[model samples]
Target chain A: MSTQSVAHDQPHASGGKYVQIAVILFVLTALEVALFEVSHEAGPTGFGALLASHFVVILLALSALKFWFVAMFYMHLKFDLKVLRYVFASSLLIAVVVISALFVLFTYNRTLWWATGVWK
Target chain B: MTAAVLDHDSADAHEEHPTSLRIDSRKLAIWTFIGSECLFFAALITTFVIYRNSHATGPGPKDVFEVPLVTAGTAVLLFSSFFVVMALNGAQEGNRKKLLLWLSLTVLCGCFFVGMQVYEFTGFMHKGMGYSTNLFATSFFTLTGFHGTHVAIGTLWLGTLLKDAYKGRIPPNKALNLEIAALYWHFVDVVWIIIFPVVYLMSLFAK
Candidate 1:
């Protein structure tokens, strides 16, 4: 985890952090583009397949990092109330459960989606 | 940056960073919206993944993609996230001029990305791949198309915000609402941060 910086007292960043973030974003984009180009071909050692798996993991991690930064800094979550954190966390957990259940049920051809669709 | 209002009032300075809520109402609301949006985006991503592998038109991810173009577009959108942070920076100090300037830059970045998207969509259409084409067609059009729509909306909203800033309504003192708006804008950019590689870049391998 990166250090938790204060959101007060000090002068705010004038996008001094931007160049670093842009560098990372560009690197990741290049890697994604490269991986996409290579995946369509059949390699001797299934390199494309192996690389695709790794690519997905890396992309997800990067995306999660983006989420954390925006939530912490841009959203000002870091300097806010602890109770508010709990509220958001609990809501997120419930939403994940509900969405996951729905996805699984629908993908599995469960009757729930049908019934739900009927109501819709 | 909404914390600026609390800056002058010494007693309020101890209150919190964003006075949008007595506590952290803005952060909480924004996160909850993000939580819901995850599913909204997930549906599109899932559809893309499911169909991406099965495009039968002989035209596929490799056939239509200009990797460099999509990659550059991704770069533009991701970099815009930084500009949003810049806006946050200005808001933090209650610097109205800086805030508006940075916000304007962010919206410009957004519009540029949207322009690239339109160009790419048309480029694909010219290749005999379009909304009416194949499995890849449906998935590609749906995912990227929704993302483009979002960028457009975000640009419009940010423009409205800049106008607000011009009228001095976004006074450095009360920056929470703008911060929340910036937060939402960042989330939109972050979503593209994921989608670019997942939907566009990864497809380069899709032969």
Candidate 2:
């Protein structure tokens, strides 16, 4: 789509604000890359549960930061129509449920992979 | 949320708020669509991350992804977002020439990004990594390839807009449309952020 597609609902003319947001996005990207480069050892048997907990926490934190950026800026959910937010939030909640269910089903049973002894 | 920003130039011209600006309308609808797409991409990312540790055969992420190239591409895509923002500013002020320039710049960046991607994919193939290589390969290709397709689509969209810029058919009133396109572009970039970490960086975690 071109600039002529939407009626200009330009944000506040404060150019600094966008520069600020862009800076934030750039920094976050760097941080994510850095996080991935940093690794930690987890449970072999002794600290297994503790390791899992730590990993889950770290992953959730990174994911949450990404979520906040997209929701706040790109989607304009931060300042614009609040009702529109429910759409994003609701869909995400549903997807999370479905994916989690898939993971649980895979872990708890064997129904999903009626493989050709090869691939799904 | 001032009356001024919402109602800037009340006397300039007024029409029904286009579907673009109306909440939970077109923009929101697209967002919901994107949300689902996020999960779609996320599924691919998660699969790649989980199975990466178990790669029975094929070029894994570390064997392929040239970080310098990808990082530069990332910067290109990010800066393109900025150009689109400038383009929007130009359009709001009714500056077609400047708008066209920035839009073209954004499109150029998209093309460059895609070019880098083609090269990257080719390089990966050269590393003996293909889609059928293994589960990790499947997920890697599906995930990044999916995003690559989006970039290609976005590039085409940008080209069409650029062509319209030349044809002088791009509506002057559709600043929101520029915004919509920019939003989608940025969202695509955002998806890469998630994937870069989950797929490219932690690729060693794949077995």
Candidate 3:
């Protein structure tokens, strides 16, 4: 409505910060690829073996960090309105829930499908 | 009039009508759309995870995925995300040249990413992993194909914005146009951020 309010709603723009975040994202991505290589080559025998054991967790953590940086900084969720955050987070939460439910259902309870005749 | 004054005037006109939520409706709508997209992609990813190992008689991840190629593509997409943000920053600062330069780079990165995906898909096909070859092939194609489609769409969106900027249509006050496109582009990047690790890397060890 008012110019003052419009200006207040606009998030601060900073190219330097975006560049910094991009560098961080690139580094994280490199780490992910390197971790994968080490784990794959290690073959459960050494330090790479240890990394291989926790590879999924480590990789997912790195990926989530990259996701967070892009969502919060690149997408301006960090500076924009809280409602936007809620909207995205809630949807993401539901997505996570759906993934978890499906994984649990299909992975551990594979028989449930046959038992319920859903596959039939 | 100074760019600052023009920006203020534009913002005021952009929101002359008060919204019930006290924010730009377009921004809110875009965010909502992004949220729904998360669910859509999540479903695709879930199917992939569920069927990741069901290769029956076709090529699997290790057979078809070239990690180095995909890693490079991922880097390009990530950089594009950065480029778009810079473009938005320039637009908001009323720096027309900066906006056009960064936006053009962003579009190029988007195209490159899409091109890389096409190459990867062709490679998969050459490796005998057709869309209906097996469960793994089907789900993998569906998931990554949708992501590539999004990249193409986003590239077109940014290309249009770049054209607009070149034509001097996007002034400091209209930076919201580019900003919205940037948001969508960033969402695509984040989706791949998840897809890369979950679908590509993790699938390497999938039993």
Candidate 4:
């Protein structure tokens, strides 16, 4: 790469932005914990129960937000080259797919050999 | 062939040759390694999820997991992620003192995290959760243990870079070394970001 392109690809130092991201992440984590606590106390039949039912979805959404912030800002993927983005994102996509499939398969088929018995 | 010139002051000094992707090869390689790590952790996580409730032979998640402690560790790790980036920022700006200071704090955070994990594992063992005690124990140990190992490795990498900075080797031109380490550190942090909620919090309510 030419000097100019290399310099252009280099991200500038922005401590302020990083600190802001960190604060946001902290708040999100607190929210996650708070949500868990609240859901833990939800009643069996009410709006609270409704909220309790969707707890996993909400928690995952919050976690995804935190993941995005760290990946974009701390990892500098937002400012890095597009090729790097493609490589990381593609692999992440495959990983997500594999995880989803495994969950679905295990959830539906509990009689598989590996799924049988605690000691086998 | 383009000769690799050592600038000793510019960040691109170690480019060696023009990469086909127009990026530093080391940076690209680290990202690729991180990408594959995603799948590796994914498989481990899947195993845990499948067997999370198989603790019928021993203590279960609710009986063992302490969310409060893990939340504190999560915060420390998140803060360390911020610290490492600031260190990178300092390094890229040619501010040696700032780099060393933040890097040192980051390493300390890493050590604290690992120590906390060791303590948590010991507590789990005390509760009769050995590696082969049950399915839950096995999967839980394997997953979190690997993550803790990564944190330890990242800590050593950053510690080495900190030493290099002390020797005036990681100048502005060679900040790529620190930057690569920072990327790995941040990747580990993000993986825990997922694990904190998915494994720890969600498991509390698992059926």
Candidate 5:
């Protein structure tokens, strides 16, 4: 809402930084795609197994890094007020909590349903 | 002379509204709105993740998603964020030509992304994977369709801002208007940055 006031009051990143960040993002994305393809062929040991087993973890990590770059630079969160940072961070924390709770509840429910011996 | 000085001081006082923290009210409001949006998108994404593999008889992500095409679309969206920022810089620097050029390019990228989604959706339907196909199809469409809607809305928002730039209404002091829209646009792109890998790439492998 007030990006207007801040844009005038604070100095923003130069054009070169924006382009550099963009390039870094492009490389990260390409790496993500490449890893996806490579993991499909990585047998079942050493680095391949690690990548195959932890595919989601690796993807999420890379994704988080990309998210940080965009949020910090493009969204100007790095230079904004502490209040704004707290607002966004708190919401994201709540979201993570909710998502984790859902996953746990669903897992527990599935086990209970499968264990209910009346049907068999 | 006293009267003229008093009038000048009154004008200066009118420009500076008293605030406890000196924070821009609009900036706080927008940040709050964006925070709420984070939760909204989180819930949707959680739903998609929950039902990601529950396709039953319908096609799954691996069968329908094309990584190469999505990568292209993602690139376009990322570049547009850069474009909008440059446009905002132009606006702040009072370079109308630079502002218009970058803003127009940003809008074009937005349109291109939406067009890619439209094409991808139609292709899915052609492959017999409609929204009601199963849980997987349903959640996938719901998540992505909502994202596409956001992009479409952003495109319209930027289009209006670009029109203003062309008409010479967006001066340096008023650059905040464009800045707010750019924030929203960048936020949209950020959401896709998460979605692309989670929904598309992660789903491709055997889980």
Candidate 6:
């Protein structure tokens, strides 16, 4: 989404596109930092809890957007062979599953320990 | 005899890869390696996240992270990504001077990023947070240290390529070399993108 026109006769993205993505990334990072500061100061009660939840979701969404931009545009995965995309995506998918499973198991164990007074 | 030898050398330089997929085998290999590296960094990151709040008696993300400083560093890495692609473009176009200029700039940006990490780690250590300080500290250092190491390696790789470019070695036919390096560089930047939010922003606010 850049207005700056780039002249390219190749199959790859132009410099203008990369600059636009970089600007978008910068904006998203700024938003993440701002959300963190606001969340850090939020009170410990009702409205603050709601704000914090929203903050976490938006912060994560911003991160994902940044990741997508870099992976797709900068890495040229968007224009490269589809098989290469699957190779990277499948590995990422497995990583997500493994990490999520571990997080869930750890959270459950923490809850059980807390109930049994196993942790202070 | 000399003309025949010269033609042989140029033909070899412009030789096409004969592959079933009609694509370069070297490119496929780099992508495969990148895929494996994805899982590798994922495991490190997941470990960091799991131990994010497990700092028994050490400083936490909220206390240690300087968002402004890191934002600058992130900008540097992102710009370096852009630079590498531009450098590749120059290489593909066979503009030796353009290739050398952009590659040098990219390498400089990478060095600046590594320097920032060194400063950050030193500051943390001075503040009593070592590798063995706590789970949070250990995981933080490990995840980020590994990334910084990758950036350092990438910088060295590009530097070597820059030397070759200066010697008039990286022509359009050999642009795949720069392309492969660019892919690795972009991957490193993407890892930091994840790390910035997951490790820094999330932890700073999760507290």
- Model 5 clash pairs are A1-B26, A1-B30, A2-B26, A2-B27, A4-B176
Clash pairs of candidate 6? none
Q: Tens-digit lDDT track for model 4 on B1-207?
A: 000111112355556666567766667777888898999899999999888889889899998999999999999999999999999888888999999999999999999999999999999999888999999889999999999999998898788788899999887767777887888899999999999998899899775
State interface RMSD in Å for all models: 7.7, 5.4, 2.8, 3.1, 3.9, 8.4
Question: Residue B32, candidate 5: how far off, in angstroms?
Answer: 1.1
Docking quality (DockQ) for each candidate = 0.24, 0.21, 0.55, 0.50, 0.48, 0.35
lDDT of 2 by residue, A8-112 (tens): 353533345656766776776676555444443333554544544354355546656865765576546676665557766776777778777776776557454
Task: Write model 6 residue lDDT over A1-120, tens digit each, in one string.
Answer: 110111112277877787788788878878777777767777777765666879867877888888898889877888887777898898888888987798788778766556776665
Tell me the tens digit of each residue's lDDT in model 1 across B142-179: 88888788788778777777787788776554565566
TM-score of 1: 0.74
**Minimal lDDT window, size 10, model 3 chain B:** B1-10
Q: What's model 1's lDDT at B64?
A: 85
TM-score, cand. 4? 0.90
Error of 4 at A59 (Å): 0.5
Q: Using lDDT, give the best candidate's number.
A: 4
Tens-digit lDDT track of model 3 for B21-137: 766555777788889899989999999989999986978888988889999999999999999999988888889989988999999999999999999899888888899999999
lDDT of each: 0.66, 0.65, 0.85, 0.86, 0.82, 0.80
* Model 3 spans > 4 angstroms off: A1-8, A112-120, B1-15
Share of native interface contacts present in candidate 4: 0.75
Q: Which stretches of candidate 6 lie above 4 Å from their native place?
A: A1-10, A42-51, A113-120, B1-17
Ranking by DockQ: 3, 4, 5, 6, 1, 2
Residue-level lDDT for B28 in candidate 4: 73
Q: Which candidate tops TM-score?
A: 3
The first chain of model 5 has a TM-score of 0.82
Error of 1 at A60 (Å): 3.2
Docking category of candidate 5: acceptable
How far does residue B152 in candidate 3 sit from its true spot (Å)? 0.7
